[model samples]
Target: MAEKTALISLNMGGPDRPESVAPFLRNLFSDRELIRLPGGAWLQRPFARLMARLRAPKARRAYEAIGGASPLRIWTECQTRAIGRLLGEEWRTAVIMRYWEPRAKEVLTHLRREGVKRAMVLSLYPHFTAATSGSSINDFCRHAVRFCPELDYRLIHDWFDWPPFLDALAHLVREALARFDGEQRHRVTLLFSAHALPEKLILEGDPYLDQVRTTMRGVLERLPEYRSRSRLAFQSRSGPVRWIGPSVTEALDTLVDEGVREVLVVPVSFVSDHVETLHEIDQGYRDYALRRGMTRFERVAAFNDDPGFIRAMASLVASRVPASWRDSRQNENGAPCQGTP
Candidate 1:
């Protein structure tokens, strides 16, 4: 058989299999990139271990709310197949959930075994955050160099600037706006909500907030007609420290105070519906809005399984991958934790 180029589809993984959830979360919480611990290594280690235990029941509960597990894995698989089809059959695609099955390291190993040298890694995150896509790529690079010494990786960092993604988001929001009762249209306040990161990260010079804000601005440019009707807020705050806010719940209350009777919650920062969107935004904040006398609260659905989103993702992959990656016919020797050489 002729050699095939491998495209590893990456995601944060789901809890579809109950037995794997804890260990999966351990990997998740262990990433210093995700959760910053106060006490350095010792505190980081014990704290992560403790958090995994304390959060399991609650995490399990949240999973059960959305069908006893997360849908990220299934959604990612669907995206992989869709993107592969879009890219043509010449490309070999595999799905890997960083904290779940078909791990980053395993996929790299498999590609090496399959005699695939060139690799295109599409991080499932549309916007880059050190905690999410950053960690995933960091993990992939570290593992790839160590395990698949002969494989070369080309990574797609952030696709937030892509026109198609902005178009799709604009389209989705417009569609939701159209669905609102015409009589209440003026009363509908569009709330753009993204997952919150620690403010400390911003102070420390991470560009995540600026990137999402820029994407939001781009999205707003497409919304001139509705520009005056919407506002931005942050969501999914964890830990004891402050997170980027004007939180969604607080924003909802403020809208009520300002006489807005309806809200359209848009999950702009995320591409998939995970616990943050499903439990926190949909269930938690929806209830909060209802209690505060907001007559209607609707979420602009996450872009899962959307054809336009897949096109945007594929375009991102096509544009960013280095041309040299196309020439490599065998895995190239590289060390783990080291970036693409």
Candidate 2:
């Protein structure tokens, strides 16, 4: 019924305000695919409400520490706008958050109203996992069928080793490493961390770990000097359920044992800053490392709206979108970025 094409970006959105935190937690905990409760499916909602009620206070404090809210929605908006501009007026761009506002249903309905006939649904997750990307994609498709069955959408799931993506990561890593001078540059162990997943998911043949490892290898290949010190660790591990190992704390402990005082942590999995990087590693890990006798700690600034990251994503959009509908705009104003105003 429509003619133009669309590019839908998927991300795990965060609470923009203090009041939204409880609801975000509830939605996150209630997701059966992302988290499995002790009881069966029938109990998930009840458990979610209780858990969210209990956890909200600490979560709100965490948000408060990081400027009273998550910058994810703002950053996602900025990133999507940049991507949209790059693709031109011919292609409409929008973002869908997994556990927050502007979710799949809302975005799909908006796209339908905008008269988008075909779409390239891209996962912001570079690595594919059932818990993250899978859940987002499944949610999008389920709602797409119900809300806009006539619209055609093609999925662009993962690009863990995509050259441009890897390059963007390398650029940030190099930028972070430059902060150190002389021996500290090479002395700092590159502690790469990613949000953790339940151990059950990995044991059941999820390729998330494998894909993340691949991304690490790609990044190391680009920066061979850091390869010797670079190591992968997991962060943001929650729940009583068994999750991935060599957590940020454990990794810090090992680095301390090895007489490594300085660490340059790279969030290998996330493309932008969220609670994981801004709060967990920046605050929690940094404080722990300091108390544990480490001298210096640094994190690779997230590639939020860096021009290079935008170019890479633009290339991805161009490739995934049908050539017939693809239209590259010639902008007299090159590489403009917008922030939350």
TM-score top scorer = 2
Measured against the true structure, the TM-scores of the candidates, in listed sequence, are: 0.91, 0.93
The 10-residue segment of model 2 with minimum total lDDT is 332-341
Tell me the tens digit of each residue's lDDT in model 1 across 236-338.
Answer: 7765577888898788888999998889988877787787889888888988999999889998888888888888877767666554455644534322342
Cα-based lDDT at residue 200, candidate 1: 84
Across residues 1-341, which tens digit of lDDT does each residue of candidate 2 receive?
13687778889989999999999999999898888876788899988898899999999999999998899888888988899889777778889999998888888998888778887778888888888888888888888888988886778778888899999999999999889998898688999897788999999988899999999999999999888888889988755689988888998999899899999998988888888889898899999999999999999999999999999998987766554443443324211111100
**Over 4 Å off in model 2, which ranges?**
323-341
Provide the global lDDT of candidate 2 against the true structure: 0.85
Which residue pairs show backbone clashes in model 1?
A: 142-337, 145-336, 146-336, 149-332, 150-331, 150-332, 151-331, 151-332
Q: Tell me how far the alpha carbon of residue 94 in candidate 2 is from the true structure, in angstroms, after superposition.
A: 1.0
